[model samples]
Target: MNADRARGAGAVRSPSTATFLSFLWPGLGQWYLGRNRLALVYGLPVVAVALAALWQLNGGLADLAIQLFAPSFSLTVLVLIVLLGVWRLISMADAFTAAPLRTKSSRRPTTLFAVLALLAVIGHAAAGFYAWSFYQAGSKMFVAGLGGDFNSVAPGASGSGTSGDLVAKPGATPATADSRINILLTGVDSSVGRNHALNDTIIVASVDPKSRHVVMLSFPRDIAGFPLWNGGTFSGKINSLMTYAGLHKDQFPDGPLPSLIKELGYLLGVPIHYYAAVDLDGFRTLIDKVGGIDINNPRAIDDPDYGGWTDGRPLGFSLSAGVHHLDGQSALAYARSRKGNGDNDFTRARRQQQLLVALARKLTDPSMLTRLPDLLAAASQTVRTNFPADRLSEMLSLSRQVKDDAIQKYVLGPPYALRSTDATTYSLKLDLAKLSALSIKLFGADSRYAANAPASPSKSP
Candidate 1:
């Protein structure tokens, strides 16, 4: 039964059948053609690679996809992919060159090839379509935030028109001709059921382009009476500067952001080169895209007012004083919570600055290469920045040079800013003398020396 049946089976198998089977699995066609030894030789390597890939993506399909594109496994994965392609080609060739079937066949080999070709075309077409769609959507979102769409009349047209062009105005001058660049990073809390959104987190970062040294100064949102671009000063909370200017667009013809940047420059006594605003919701997405952020919570944060998606029920959030890996929502709460721990706005401001540092640490990680797409998508939706896209290389260079210990953080509280009671609200009054001294120490030095200075970093207050 063994040798007789084997001979008869080999006689009946066709080359087309062999090719189709090999197309499905590297050695499957050989096995189908009654060549057991050759099938193992061809399929084992491919099967091993597939198994290794599955192992690497043990977390899930989503996790596997992220790992595939990540920087760590990029080279190895690429090599494996090339090997697999070659193996598949060999498999198909072996199948098609095999002996033709002797017995009557149920389906023609050409019919099978046609079906495979159609499937391959459909798969590639679908992939290409999605890729193009993703690219277009991302481009539109980036342009929308990078610069206003400008719904006014196009150059010569009399009627109102919409332009897709991204016209980013030149940001303010670098503090010292590229020696240092300063940017205003504002976090806005604009959620559902709220008519007005407040710039709750305001941080001014001065980065040394050459050394990649960075100094971040966090200003409390409640600091009032800050001067605006126009003659009038921001009478209420300093955080309201942008919102007020936005409301009074007549006084601020260039738009609220420009006016706010100019005023902030005046207040800080340092030229702010650019501004990047992220919606509070965007912060969550950004954090998640980077696989979350790691932060050392110096003090426990417990906020009774921590609003969440839970219907009408407050998220009585709390974080212990220790190193914690926080997801987007938890990180947001950590950065925004101001109650239940006897912490004031100043504490929250410090936490916000710390969160930024943590985010920077996460982004500079070599593993983030695979996460770039998700991050870019999140940024397009949640962030609006005047920072030029063409200058991204320079930014990346600076970011690479930024050392964790070299980041100097200053929160305007206590000696730098005094708490004052205003009606029912508590506001901060800037101590001009102290703020000037801090600014000079952080930003007034020469770029080269400022970057390499051996001064010990100050701990966050």
Candidate 2:
């Protein structure tokens, strides 16, 4: 054979050794072959991409991985995933096929490859288990925490019937073109120094499955005299329903929350499919976990009882007009504050709805990955809901499909509900006709009270 042909066909190092080494570190095999320049070429880009991801995710590569599932950033995530896959493949191929000048490798290729393969399999299995456990933990926490006083009934209510008995009749359908799902989101402060956690924040999120449209309807806490289930009226402020049910227990057999759910359905003329109650105290932890939230403060807010540290002033918390980034405490104060201009129970209700939307946007951000564990922990402790675990995938899918601009917001105060003084105290006297019209327009039909709904509202709420 010719000298050139002999050189080309010379003996090389173990292909298995090179493949294992490259698998360990993208270019380690090339470096072992004394191909420093080639190693840099194969490794640097991968390292750079990894570093960039870490920086953007606030040192959380796992968060970036999770974010890949989010619809908004799927394209970018797909590209990065493809690039990484191609790089790994190229590195492995180059390492395995590279001609080695030496007769043998220092380490036993078979043993080394076996060890690496075993470790990889074990690590992958452990990771899968951990992810599943984490999801289960979060799911259980959410379900248990959000479920309202399950056995409690409000005063004057008879604990005779269960919620299953009161809900829309089986197989009942919507009155409009699309089906709508309404979820009641309640926020309460039942922490230290508070006598009872009255649900100060009451919101009904109406989701249209077909159009992917959403309408958030805020209910003021002061609305009273709404008829309750099991006969009699829900006395006192509307927000006090949960507390009353909890205290009575006898009146609300299915729980105090179900009473409010039924009442809300009656008031709005819409079927409330599910309910979630979150303790406001954990609001700060949740906000901090997502690296805080941004809100456009149209006017200055100054509250004396805003809870802890007010920049050396007796006033507990103060946020100036304009856009502000709020940590958990500040955000909580902003949402809880009823001292600013346009800041009443009504306005506070609207702010609470706005805060939810803002927080949702913040949680979807990539930087939220590192804090996701903490956020879920806080939620597990703070949130209580009747939303079933089986419907989680559906919720995620609906959330992804819902567009921002398609959302319609309504505060059941002011023009729709006039603040008035009843015989005992103040309450929002709702214009039932107007309110029903608005609900139909924003929520798009109701299966429960199809005949009661009026014409659409002249303008958006």
Q: How do all models score by TM-score?
A: 0.64, 0.68
- Residue-wise C-alpha lDDT for candidate 1, range 19-38, written one tens digit per residue: 77777788988777677778
Q: Which stretches of candidate 1 lie over 4 Å from their true place?
A: 1-141, 144-170, 173-178, 309-314, 369-374, 421-424, 445-461
Q: How close to the true structure is residue 408 of candidate 1, measured as C-alpha lDDT?
A: 80
Native-referenced Cα lDDT, model 1:
0.64
Q: Candidates' lDDT values, in order? A: 0.64, 0.64
Backbone clash count, each prediction separately: 1, 11
Candidate 2 residues 148-203, lDDT tens each? 44322111112222435554321123454345677888787666677766776889
Give the Å error, residue 338, model 1: 0.9
The collision pairs in model 1 are: 14-101
